[model samples]
Target: MGAGLSGLACAITLEKHGISPAVFEVRERLGDRFVNAESMLSILQKPITDPVAFFAEKNGIYLKPTASIQRLLVFSQSQKAEIEGSLGFINYRGRHEHAFERQLGRQVKSAIQYRSKATYEELLMEYTHVVVATGDGEYTRKMHNFRTDLTVSLKGAMVTGDFDRYTPCAWLDYSYMEKGYGYLLPLSDTEANLVMAYPDYPENDRLDVDERWGLFYERVCRDLRQPLRITSHFHVTGYPIGICRRARIGNTFFVGNCFGALMPFLGFGQFTALLTGIYAAYDICGKGAYEELTQPLRRSYENSLVLRRAVERLDNEDLDRIVPVLGSRWGESILQGKSFNALRWLAFALRPWMTKR
Candidate 1:
């Protein structure tokens, strides 16, 4: 029921497997579900990963994979730290909400209905099968009846402005949340991102971004111990974040936040969204050409549930340590090429949950 990364990936994958699937997005635009000021969609691709190559070759999107990204910084209201690394980075600009839509739309334009809405019963009557990828929302919960707890909360804040040009790499500031952290990802010399995650659910009220702009500005100045200025105020808003317990139900399977979501420990929700989209395509393809497709989705859903719980525990227990470790030699010692713990693998396995295949 979404046309985001997962939904797009599923559309492409289904076409590859010779099956056409329709996509429905709630937002007026494709990528309106979330927002980012200055961030990097870090894709650790080296030349030939299908997804990587696809973006690069098709869009003239060239990325340097050799640790061009360095400098990991973490911050709390009172504490902050920085480290160095060679992690790669990708700078994607423009209305990304519509970027993927343009690509996928080209392949299956007939299959997608944008600016559209459909109730569950109405949807069931229109299509032979229904796959819900509507992200983490109320309808998803009622449809699946999965045991979910929206208690643990997270707030993501992003800012874009000029920094002192002291960094040639990415800097993550994870000193907040006692168990959370903030990021200072460099989109370029002129722009930097201030994204932070806190354990408390973000206040539903709109953030007076201008009023709080000074807080971030002061922090950056204090951290660098240099003068700072805000020439412009771009945009600001806060949304509620929670983790789900079940991913699939009967013929209606929940992918993306509908199934489960990764904690905001490291700002990997976008990565998770992308991953869930890919898996959704696979699961749908696994279903017989014209047969029911819920079994495989159920299996995948269970796996995601377990991983989500584990991540919640990690977020609840030791996220603070994770940032410190990432900035410390200890973390560098364990990070390997595309080989993180089983939890990461689980995220990769569940990317499709956000897509409609």
Candidate 2:
């Protein structure tokens, strides 16, 4: 039960089938507590093919699709590479609900009970089917014991400044220690997103998030040969940047970063969250309106586990090589080809379970 993109999507899907899904969100707003803009790649890959459009159409809302498509610059521990693809970009929800959050909110506004949190006992007593979308590990202890955990640690900082020079350049620098990388994604001409992760790095273990971010920000500026003009700063908003221990449990389903967030190396979890939610919707509908739908939830959860493993492998291997070569002439050449696009699409289609919607 959450109000984030995943939970909203799940609720909307159920309502679409006339099931009248009830949502319990811990927060008051449709989006989570975080302030940074998330990256969307696949589900919104194309304007017409995007789920935002689908939800808007079904719910009678006007959602204007904004395309900030660009190639991903992967920074591996060892080298750099460029991944070419049609990346889908959307703002979650802010005002008029023009982004991902607004579209999903419009679908399930009446169903969601904002500021109402559900405990284990309270949840089991209420809905006949409970879908757990909260990003809290403590809540799932008794009912679900998921062994899936992440090794990497995630830390981030949001800065509002002129990133105009790096707008489309979106650099992914991996000059950090082994299994660590720095990211620079441009949200707009005035906004830039910076995130860094370390799988085994423990520099922040001894210090609080602010202190660690202070040190990290200093380092990033030094490397970039620039000054830190942070008009606004939000750093290391959360801790222990690892995947969730479990995804699905009994009649409850999980989606989004709650299941397991991919490492920053992939930078596709935002897209994955929406895709997984859609897939969960499909699974629920396929089983028909009955408690028997729990079976498909289990299968989807198992499938997520397998996909997470593959992602771990990719993070540990390809990323170290890919990050260094981003934004280069060679990277541009690779992205300009149609063969790479075909291969990427085929690869995702080949693994239906892992495909990002």
Candidate 3:
């Protein structure tokens, strides 16, 4: 129903199969006003395949990237570790069409009903099949009685700093941050994006988001020893991330963050969004392969939930121990979607249960 990345992807996939599709978007323009730069990790692990290229070769769909993140500066609550690796390709999610949507929009000549607001009821009344690509699915949530919800309270700002465009900091501190972490993504030598996101915690219940962002920025500077200054900040968008019980309801399907396709560990969803959208298209074509194709992603998302719970229970000492593992080869493998250390992950997941609140 919506024409963001997933919605557009759904439409493009249908069109590829010789089916004409109509799209509706709530916003006048796509990818505008959703502020953030995303990292697209390659679907292939070893030799690190490019996600855009992989999609192009496999689905006849392609995406362009604005920047590539080359290195990672990871920090525990107190300890610091730097790793030379490809975090992912970074694309600007400015107040306009992002790299992916712009490329897809050009390829598919769909009559997008811009500024159109159609309810699910309205959609079902006309179309034989409805694909709900509404990013955040409020209706689906209510319909399914899905209970799990995590708050990703994020604040972004343009900051002037002498920084390496390829190197960014990912700060994880269960102390001040509780269940959240902060990041610094440099777009250029003088301009960078600072974002902090964490699950819901009571420690920040009373503080305003601006105050919280100030602390987060200050902590990033202190940890990295960078004296960058925030030129301006944007309003905080603390949205909920949860797994949908089902993406399909009768003839309607959900994709993207609406179905909680984002990784539960760090809340990256672009890959899942695209994958699910294409699968939804397959389902509509009578293939019904959406569930089979997206099964691995669902398992990974569930695994991330376990990891998130473990992070919540960890103390400053535990975080110090955890930081090094994340910088090691094993951690790199885990990040690349290569393999998971089941025993180690289980230990982390069970650590929280040892102590009671």
Candidate 4:
């Protein structure tokens, strides 16, 4: 019911399959959602195979990558390691959406209705199919009765700097942020994003998020010997993370964050979102099952829960040991979508709940 990437993607896919779908958006401008929303660019780990190229070729849709990330400079409080390999890509958020959305707009402009508040009941009353891709919000839970296992507040800001955009930086210092990590991802040598993400706690309400982010960022700068200049306004928000239990409820199917597509540990959703959106169109055409389409990804994320939970329990010494391991062949295998027994390290994480499509 919204004109985010997923919604527009679904619109394009549906039209491609000869089903005319009307996408309704709350924003007046095509990319206003991105311009006014979160500022952090997402870092997605590439699959062993090219899922996007495969699907795009099959479905007649275009998935353009704005930036490619080749390596990552990972750090702890006292240690730093440069992981060399294909880390993944970054699809910028915030103002960067202007270009991306406009690119998608040309393909599906005829199907979108700007500044319209379309509801589930309203859409279902008029159309045979309804796919919700409104992203992570309370509406998904309220409408579909989906569950939220946990949520984390993320604070991000753009800074002026001359740094390597190819090698994004990550900090896993537990003392600074026990539940989550901090990152510095550069769009170019003159611009970058500084992000601090941690589990939402009771103390967050008492202290400001920017101040909290500053506290963590200060330690990152000091420990890493970086003199970054903050240049843009701070943006703060949270997504309902963790594994979702269901993707479809009767005629209404949830895609994107509405379907709990975000990975709780690292918050990568765009890759999942685009694939799910196309699957949603496929489901509407009776070509596939939405739940079945999303199950493999859910399983992969569930498997990753084992590593995510262990990172929470790690201290500086542990992070020091882990950063080097991520660059090793074993860690690279797992990151490349191969099977790895992360559980063998005496680590226990949340079990995968039975998910419905």
Of the candidates shown, which would achieve the greatest lDDT relative to the real structure? 3
Total colliding residue pairs, candidate 1: 26
lDDT of 4 at 232: 68
| Lowest lDDT block of 10, candidate 1 | 40-49
| lDDT (tens digit, per residue) of candidate 2 on 10-51 | 776766666777778777766554555555444222223344
Q: What is the clash tally of candidate 2? A: 17
Candidate 1, residues 1-90, lDDT tens digits: the string is 777555665566667677878778766755553433322333222122243444456433222221244554554343344555544343
The true-versus-predicted C-alpha distance at residue 293 of model 4, in Å, is: 1.5
CA lDDT of every candidate: 0.47, 0.52, 0.73, 0.67
Q: Where is the poorest 10-residue window by lDDT in model 2?
A: 165-174
Best by TM-score: 3
Q: Clashing residue pairs, candidate 3?
A: 32-96, 180-198
Once fitted onto the true fold, the runs of candidate 1 whose alpha carbons sit more than 4 angstroms away are 33-68, 75-82, 86-111, 144-147, 151-180, 201-213, 225-246, 287-325, 337-357
* Ranking of models by TM-score: 3, 4, 2, 1
Global CA lDDT computed for model 2: 0.52
lDDT of 1 at 178: 32
Candidate 3 C-alpha lDDT tens digits along 1-357: 888778888899999888888898888877667455667754322233567676789888878776676778888867887666665777766463555776778777668888887887898999999988887767777787344567677767878888888887888875445677787887767777888776656776655766767777788787767788877666555577787777677888878877667776677788778878888999988767676766766666776676666667677788799889867887766655534445345645665663343
Clashes (N, CA, C under 3 Å) per candidate: 26, 17, 2, 1
